[model samples]
Target: MIERELVIVGGGPSGMAAAIAARENGVKDILLLERDQYLGGILNQCVHTGFGLEYFKEVLTGPEYADRFIKKIRGLPDIEISLRSFAVGMTGDKVVTFLKPGRMERVKARAIIMATGCREKTREMVHIAGTRPSGIFSAGFAQKLINIEGLLPGKEVVIVGSGDIGLIMARRFVLEGAKVSGVVEIQGQSRGLVRNIVQCIEDFDIPIYFNHKISRIYGRDRVEALDAVRVDENFNEISGTKFALKCDTILMSVGLIPENELIEMAGVAIDRKTNSPVSEELNKTSVPGIFVCGNSFKVYDIVDSVTRDSLAAGKLAAEYLGRARA
Candidate 1:
């Protein structure tokens, strides 16, 4: 088993920032563990620009901004990063179970910080009536495929949500030679930023159907068609508004849920709106020495907020460590 003075779980923006902040704040022997091959979690796969406007004072893509922190991480002598390590479970008393190489080991730390990020809620959670088909996909899944894997998800598609991911995918697929017929939203107002609506969907001339949902899917082997309809008050169906959208692909951009399984295990009080650990100003979780920040805290409308929150959490975590020792 390995040991360290402090361990930060999940090597995303928050975790990376936490490590840097902790070390700079005078904490030594810091270790950042990630389950992915690369240091940046989820950010590496996001290829589109619009990140780092506030924190860096420059417009950058996800990877580019993440690279900025990655560079900083390498410069710190007190920080050690473990790639391809799964933070499987943490015991109630703060013993962390993680897998490295072929062995499962437990690592103990005086202070623990959870920077585990959020993940997309898939089609199954949407509860829409549909046959299990091959062509169906989540917007984030499609983005990962085309952006990172260099694979095309489909040539003709109908998106089922108007979240930023869906709206962004609408433009992404169109640019990749896919015909993105339309984007559907369950609410009258889009769940995404105003800029995304104007840039991703409206700029591409892709129609966004408001207050509509996929009532059913018509496909046997692959998604061949979709039945979209409008909704009224209480989300009831609006009569005589059903229309069969002819498309070979259907993308679900339903919603996002914070990946806080580890946080849940820690028994920290979580915010219902975020499904992540609740924090007032310091990004400290209900559990002391266990903090959470970034998208896992709340779905920030701006990446600037994410970075700012991380910086705050990291600094606060360092202070918490000192206080605990005192």
Candidate 2:
């Protein structure tokens, strides 16, 4: 077993920020573990520019914002980065077990930071009744397919939510020469930022159906169409309001849930509704010497906020280590 002063369980914006802050606060031994081959996490696939306004005082793309911190981490010799390391287990005593390419390793640290981030809600989570089809995808997964893999998901698309990602992807599909039939939302107003609603929807003249939902999806091999219905203020389907939309793809942008299962496995109390850690203070969890930052603690809408809170988690880990030594 390898031992370290700090072990950070993610290498995205949160993990990188925490590592930098901990190093600045005099925590020398630091390990940053990333599951992906690259360190940027979801930022790697986010190519649009709306990030780093508050943190860097400049607008940057997702990759660009992540690059700034990645460069800083490379320059700091005290921080160790392990890419493609999937953390599998965490003990109450801060022992993290992760699996790499061909080997599994364990690290026991004086302080541990979980920057595991969050996952998107799927059709099942939203109780959308549909035949399991090939063209259904989460908004984030579609973003990755288009941005990173350089492949379009489909030619005709229908987004099933008015969240930020769904709004942004509506523009992306149009830019890529695909037809966005419309966006369906059960709420009266969009859940996304106003700026996104303007830039991604109204600017492109994309149709958005407010107080509507995709009640049923129709397809056998791939997505053929969707059964949409108008909902009352209580989200109940109104009689004789069902309609059908023809589309080849369906994208779900319902919501995001914090990834806190590993922390819960380590005996940390978690809020069932939000799936976030129950913390007394910011970045401080119920368990001592184990801190959580970024979306693992709470889902933030912007990356800048994630960086801000993660920096604090790093400092807290450094202070915890100092007390452990004293």
On TM-score, the leading prediction is 2
lDDT per model, in order? 0.83, 0.92
In candidate 1, which residue ranges exceed 4 Å CA deviation? 271-273, 278-282, 323-326
- Candidate 2 ranges with C-alpha deviation above 4 Å: 323-326
Q: Kindly list the per-residue Cα lDDT of model 1 for residues 1-326, writing each as its tens digit.
A: 66667888889887888788788887888878899889887788778899988888999999998899999999999888989889989855567888888988788877787787778887888788978788998889898999889999888899988888888899999998989888888888899889999999889899889999889988899888888999996788898999988888888888888777786786877777768777765576777777777777776667667777787777777777783232
- At residue 234, candidate 2 shows an lDDT of 89
Query: Could you tell me the lDDT of residue 43 within candidate 1?
Result: 81
RMSD of each: 1.9, 1.5
TM-score of each: 0.95, 0.98
Candidate topping lDDT: 2
